[model samples]
Target: MTARFDVAVVGLGAMGSAALAFLAARGVKAIGFDAYFPAHALSSSHGDSRLIRLGYFEDPSYVPLLKRAYQNWRSLEARLRTDILTITGVLQIGAPDGKIVSGTRSSCELHGLAHEALDKAEMARRFPAFQLDDHEIGLLDPQGGYLRPEAAVMGYLKLAAEDGAVLHFGEKVTAVEPDDAGVTIVSDTGQYRVKKIVVATGSWIAELVPQLRRAAVPIRQVVAWYQPQDGFATQPQRMPCFLRDEGAEGSYFGFPAIGVDGVKIGRHAHFREPIDPNQPNPPVNEADLALLDGFIRKRVPGAAGLRVKATTCRYTMLPSEDFLLDHMPGEKNVVVASPCSGHGFKFTSVIGEILADLAIDGQTDLPIDAFSFARI
Candidate 1:
């Protein structure tokens, strides 16, 4: 007998795992597939921490979605009896006129999100981890903090399985074929027939949907953890997660000391080097660390101690850098999610719910019109 699922979510990483959990919770016969196990380092969703905040400088429209995502994360935490979100606050410091500072202020005002506008002097007095230029200022979202990427993935997948959603971990989904009858999914292990399909494959989305090959390009990203200087207060209690805009030099993001890993930091899109997701990631090289080294040394010298650990991840990018979340072109039954352009792990919870809504209900009340496929 051919096993039939009402919905099949491919790629159980950040988005797929959440979608499966939501679908199963809705009592839909859902099945999820992933090439690797949940929380695996190979996937972009495995980093120990990813930031989440309400005053989204990226766009004010995303504020509503972020609010829901925060709620969903707390619910998942309660259900799993775990701490997925930790409030250390989030700080963005840059030119008062820069995208990060100005844009964040706009979103805060538009959404009435709790925030504080801090000048360089105030920023220095509060968080002395980094040196801010006189022209630069800080926008602090007190409710913002970091989320455990691995735990969230595992938690969501566990909930999905407990709710009777079939999960195929480490099974590769090689192809997707859709027709009037439904969608046919061909995997290395077996085949499946589902009424609809959601593709959340992250970096490898193009392989399953050829039409998106040029639209979704995968690039390598690097993150490194360094031991902090003794004199500096780099712990979460003293310093919040921070993003600094160096303008032409490139943007950099970092976290306070967490666990034994020390202080972690990385350049947003190091070198913009595109890579084949199927192959092993290139080792963290001197060239990769050079940019981060100079940035930290020039700005936050307190975190410029010996590098403790370094690893590479991939980001499936779109030309616009905004997320690509919508029904496939000319294929309404197929939902494609994420290539979240580097800043997406935080939205995993809400994105999953949106994917599930689009799959089962054919539409979502979420304002994703700006992320339509027509723009790509």
Candidate 2:
């Protein structure tokens, strides 16, 4: 026997879980499917934490969506009775003219956001953990912080189930065929028919949607956690999340230890080598450690202590590294959402709501033109 639903959400990681949760809350007959269980470490959403910042350096146009995303995140926390977002302030540091510093200042100025501009000395005084060159400056965004990725995913999935969403975990979706009336989704367990479909599959997008194989490429990324030494404090009160544009070495971002007794750091532009998500993730190597060592030695104080652990994840990137959200060509019944390039988890709250809106209403009030696949 086949199952039927008003909407079938494929890949219930971040976006799909939110879509299902929203639809189910609305009393829509929604069903969700995922290749792995929610909050599983195999995918992008498994990382312990994700940074949330209002001063987006990628583009200032993201501020509006971010504002809405913040509200949604708060609402989700209230609804689920779970603590998710933690505001520890954020510092975007680099040369005054660099993308990380200038772009963030531009966004804050344009959006009328509250932020502080600190020179090298002020930065050192305010955040003792950071080591800066004399010419470097820091743009501190007080609203920026981190989100617990695994907990957020589980919360959304749990609420979705309570709201009447039928979820099939560890069920691989083999194909999604759109028809005149709706969409037909075939999985390893059974077939599902729905009036609409939302494809939020992250790294495995190409495997299911052949047309997007070339557009969405998955890149291997590694994140490492290190115990702070004597001088620096990893606690939220002292150290905030940080991003630095290290000129040639590439951009690096990290968070102060939350529950763990270590700080987490990852290169935003390192090890972007393409990988097949279907294959086992390669183990973290010494070269990765050496790369991070350079950053820690130069910038972060007391971050060179014992290296606790490191893990790898896939980053599905577009050429521009912006998000990709749109409907399948000639098929309005199916909406495709790939909000991840690298920094996407923070926006999951609004992305899910947008996916639900697109799948049900066929339109959304949010500004998503920047992520339209038509541009590609």
Candidate number of the best lDDT: 1
Q: So what's the TM-score on candidate 1?
A: 0.97
lDDT tens readout by residue for model 1, 181-255:
688899998888889999999888889878778988889999988888843588898889988888887788888
Clashes of each: 0, 0
The reply for model 1, stretches above 4 Å from the true place, is: 1-3
lDDT of 2 by residue, 1-376 (tens): 2437899999988878888888888888999998888767668888788999998888999999999999999999999888999999999989989988899999999999999989988876778888899999888999999998888888998889999898888899998988888888889988878899998898888776677888888888998888888434657787889999888778999998675648889999477888888888888899998988777877886676787888888888888888877788889998888847888899999988888888888888999988887776
Residue pairs in candidate 2 whose N, alpha carbon or C atoms collide under 3 angstroms: none
For residue 264, model 1's alpha carbon misses the true position, in angstroms, by 0.7
Query: Which 10 residues in a row give candidate 2 its minimum summed lDDT?
Result: 230-239
lDDT of all predictions, in order shown?
0.87, 0.86
